[model samples]
Target: MTSQNKSVPAFGYEIIRDYALSTILGKHADDVLYWVGKDIARKFPCSDIQLIISFFEDAGWGTLSIEKEMKDGYIFQLTSDPDLLNIKNRKFRMEAGFIAEQIQCFKGCLTECYDEKKEKQSVVQFTVKWDTKEKIG
Candidate 1:
């Protein structure tokens, strides 16, 4: 996917994404955010991978790229500014859920996504796997 040059203020974004949501949601923040991501995906669906990547950039999430393609899944890498990565107790579950639902909608299958934070690399890796047998109707 092509990259976009647009940017958003990290400070304000984090205040809502990391601080406010986490403070209000507390222990359930991750789970709630994941579902919220899915809901957002439903509200704004992307039919192709490029559109999905563009959506991420437009949402000020980060730059998303495909790291690898598997038979039934895909691995995506998300990267942003170093300062964003350095934030304490940051979470990417919302992005993960958005990916899962987006792929499910695109492929018409049951899909799931999980994210792994690589602090050393300052990146988040998302794994999206779909069950071909379980078609979504």
Candidate 2:
């Protein structure tokens, strides 16, 4: 599989970044996190670093630091990690496993889902993670 255009962010890249921030800090990212102190703050919400890391570990994406969060645009590299990039154009079953895993971890949310195809007379089901920073505190 190839394409004429390249350099596109994956399906949920921005969402994951936002989720990382909101979940860790209990606040919306008015700007993308980029600096070391800003990054540190993301990990240490009101100075609780351990809990933030624990949250990431529990979520199963492993420990995610700020890496680099661009204010104007996405830090494309940081926003789209290798694992996520690896999954594009993969099998449905594989995608489901990742999605299910993320949902089970509680680092994200499950929104509504509907299947586009019904070829086998079966209903395929899925849940989408929440993609925004909100007041969860």
Candidate 3:
């Protein structure tokens, strides 16, 4: 398929995301998408948190904002534009997994990510944590 404009509309992309991906992946959508995100992070490694935040925006994932940074981990929140938020048709596990892998690779330790979706508030929060004592070699 070729487009004269060379840019697909956001609605078109969402259609593929909502229908194509779900249809293809079916029951394993969540798990597979998460792995795919991790794979993407591996291929395009981010050198710093700034790059990670930019990656999210550039990829049309959403706006990533750091809420807090703690000794062992960090908390981030993702929010879409008001229009997109009203649509309520997003799958963010992919983002969470991507972040988990990135943090794990960067810190050289075992890492985990937890996502909380606040539909009412139109926000998705991701908590990424790594054990400093546990290193990955």
Candidate 4:
């Protein structure tokens, strides 16, 4: 199918992603979604940050940007149109998990990601940290 045909409306996407999944999975939704995101990353791995950014856009997640870099980790910001930004109680754990897995693959180390929701600013910030001492073979 063409990209346009494959596209899903924001409301529809939200209904499934936020509402349906939460309703079905309940309190476990976030954790399950996080692992699902990691599985997706493993299936469609991105070797570079640019590819990751492109993936986010193509998936209609949002605009992903690097906010800061640290010795052990990096900070990322996600922003979207008003439709998504205005969503009530939207969680970004999936996105965080995706980034964590991607970075772990890239850095060959154990990595974890935490997300902060800035509802007032309509933004989500992710902090990705890796354990340099624990390398993956």
Order the candidate numbers by lDDT, best to worst: 1, 4, 3, 2
Instruction: Report the lDDT tens digits of candidate 2 across residue range 53-122.
Output: 3544443333333323332111111112445533232212322333323332343332221112222322
Scored by lDDT, model 3 comes in at 0.84
List TM-score per model, in order: 0.89, 0.20, 0.88, 0.93
**Candidate 1 lDDT by residue in tens digits, 25-133:** 9999989989998999999999999999999988878899999999999999999887866434689988999999999998999999999999888899999999999
Against the reference, the lDDT scores of all candidates come to 0.89, 0.33, 0.84, 0.87
The C-alpha stretches of model 4 lying farther than 4 A from their native spots are 1-5
Residues 36-57 of candidate 4 have per-residue lDDT tens digits of 8898899989997888899998
Model 3 CA lDDT for position 103: 86
List clash counts for every candidate, in order. 0, 0, 0, 0
Predicted candidate 3: what Cα RMSD to the true structure?
3.0
User: Where does candidate 4 clash, by residue pair?
Assistant: none
lDDT of 1: 0.89
Check candidate 3 and list the clashing pairs. Answer: none
